[model samples]
Target: MLVEYNYVIICSDRDFSLDLKFRLKKYEDLAFVSFAKDKTEGLFVILKHRPDIVFINLSKNAPEYFKMVVELRQYFHNLPIIIGISNDKQYVFKAIKNHFFDYWLLPYSEWDISKSLLHAKAQIPEKTEPKTLCLKSYRDFQYLNTDDILYLKSDNNTTCFTMKNSSEIIAYKTLKVFEKQLPEQFKRIHQSYILNTDCVSGINYGKNLCTIAFNNSQVPFSKSYIKNIDELKKKLAQSAIFANK
Candidate 1:
C-alpha cells in the first residue's frame, strides 16, 4: 500500500489556504486532513489528529505558536514536521531555532514549496507501523494484519502462522522466506520459530523459553539466540513501571 501523509493547516488567511489547496493537487501522497484558525485551536486539533505535517501561519504570534509546539512535547516524544509561513524573513531564524521543517515566504513560490516537500519526504519516511502482510500463491491471495500474528513456525518447506485469534494459517513458503519480510517486532528466536516480541510476556533464562502472553504458551529459544533475547528483555523492561531481578 502506498503511504499517504496527512497534514493540518493552521492559518487565518483563507486566500493562502485556498491557493495552497489548489497547488497541492499535484501531490497525490500528501493529503490535507484538518484546518485551524489560530494557534490555540491548532494545538487542540493537532493533538487530536496527530498529522504527519503541520503548516503554521507564523505571520502573527510566532513565539506563541512555538510555545504551543513545545507544550505538545509533554504528550509526544516525536512532534509533527512543522512548516512556518510568514511574510517576514525574520521569522526564518526563529523557525530554524525551533527546528521547523521549512519556512515559506508569504508571497508563496510554487517551486520552493514543492522542493521543500520533496526534501521533507526524503527526511521523514513512510509510517510503517501495524503493516499488512500479503501472502500470494498462484491465483490465491491472503492479506493478514501483521498486528494479529502471534508467531510463525517452520514445518519442512511450509510455514505456519499462529494468529492472536487462535486460528492457524499455512503458507506454502519456507519460514526463512518470511523471516525478512515481517516487521522488526517479529524476531528469529530459533531456526524453526520466529516470535512476535509483543506477544511475549516473559522469558525463562533457566529453561531458555519465552512465554507467549496472548495464549500462555511457552516457546523455546536456543542459546544461540540469547543475544536477541537479552535485547528483547531490555526493550520490554523500558516500558515496565518497575522490574526486580
Candidate 2:
C-alpha cells in the first residue's frame, strides 16, 4: 500500500538545502518544507501540523538536542515518527534511546528514505486484519497474529509474548526487534515490557509511571520508558480531537 503522511524537515546547515526538499517532493502525498535556521520554528511546525514524521539533523552538542526531544515528547508523545540524521554512533544511539524511530547518515539518499518509510509503515498497524509476526530460532519458529497478543515482556536474554488464550511464548528477541514490526500503537513502557497504547487505562504521572490494564491484569510502566509512553498519550489526544471534528 502507498502510505501518504505529512512531514516536517529541520536542517540547520545549507549544504543539502534545495536537494533534500526536491527529493522529498517525489513522494506525492508527503507535504514537506525546509527550515532555514530556527530550531524553535521547526518544533512549532511539528506541533502545529502534527505531521507523520520529523526528520532532523543531529547537532554535535546533543544534550541540548535531547532537551528539544523531551519537550516534543511532552506534547507529541506519540508524535508520528522521528528520524534523526547523524553519522556519529553516540548521537545515533542517544536518539534511539530517546525513542526516535530511526537515524540515518547526514547525506540523505533515496534508499535510506525509502527504508525509513517502510519501517514507518510497518509500525502503523492496519485494522483490516490482525498483524502476524514470526518468531525465529535455531530449533523452531512460530507465527502469532496481533489478535492473539495480550502483551509482551522482556527478561534479560529472552522476551515473553503473552497471548489472549492465556498462553505465553518465550523467544529470543530484543525489544528493538519487536518494536520495528509492531504498530505505533504498541509502545515500550518499561525496559522489559511493551504494551499497546490502547490498552493503557491511566497514567500516574506523579509516580513517573503508568499502568496498562490488560486482560484482567495490570502492567507497570518502567520509569526509563515513561517518556515514550507519555508521548503516545499526546498522539492519542490529538487523534481524539480530529475524530471529534
Candidate 3:
C-alpha cells in the first residue's frame, strides 16, 4: 500500500515558500504539503496536522530555526525534519549533529527534494500487522481476533462466528468467502459448519458429531465429510505419539 505522507513547510520568504509548495505538489499522490509563514505558525500547524515530515528554511535565521527544531523535538521526537540551507557549508555539520533527515543547499532541484522526501518516508516505522478480522456490517465494522473464534455456522447468505466469549458475530459474507481467507487450521467439517481444528476435543463417530471442548459444543458432519473426521483422528493420534516420544 502506498503511504501518502502529509508534510508542512516552515519558511518566512513568500516567493520561496510558493516555489517550494509548487515543487512539492508535483508528487501530489505521494505527498500532501501545508505551509506556515514562520516558526510560531508552524508549531500550530504541526500540532493540528500531525504531519509525517517537516521542511524548515535555515538560510535566513539559523538561531530561530534551531529553536523551532528544539521545540518540535520536545513533543515529536521522531518527526523527520528537512533543512534548507544556503551555499555556506558551516550549517551542514550542525544539521548532521542535530539528526536532520536531509539538507538541500539553495536552488532546490526536483531530484534533491524527491530524494529527501523518500528518505523521510523511510524513517517512518512500518505499520504493525493486523491480527484481528475486521468485519463490516451496514454502518460500522467490528474487530475480532482469529484465536477468539471457536467455529463458524452458516445460515443462508449470512455466516455467524461463535467466539470463545460465548457471543456470536453475524457477517453478511458467505462461508466460502471466509474459508478462503481463514488460516489453514480452520477445516470445513460440514456444509453449514467450519471448525477450528485447534479447538476440537473429540469426535463421536457413532453420532457423526465433532465436539469442541473449548465451548462444550457439538457440530455434525455429513457423510461426504466423514473423511475429514478420519483425517482429524489420524492427526490426533500422530500428535499423541509425538508427545510420548
- For model 2 the local lDDT of residue 171 reads 84
Candidate with better lDDT, 2 vs 3: 3
lDDT of 2 by residue, 26-132 (tens): 77867674353446776777777877777777754456656777888788647678787776666876887889898877566779888888788677544343378
Residue-level lDDT of model 3, residues 51-148, one tens digit each, is 77777788777677777777877887576655555656668877777777777887767787778777767777765434588898788989888888
Instruction: Provide the clash count, candidate 2.
Output: 4
Q: On lDDT, who's better, 1 or 2?
A: 1
Q: Which stretches of candidate 1 lie over 4 Å from their true place?
A: 129-245
Q: CA shift at 207, candidate 1, in angstroms? A: 52
Identify the runs in model 2 with alpha carbons over 4 angstroms from their true place. Answer: 1-3, 33-36, 125-245
Task: List the candidate numbers ranked by TM-score, top first.
Answer: 1, 3, 2
Number of the top TM-score candidate: 1
Top-lDDT structure, candidate number? 1
- For model 2 the local lDDT of residue 52 reads 78
Alpha-carbon local distance difference test for all models: 0.87, 0.72, 0.79
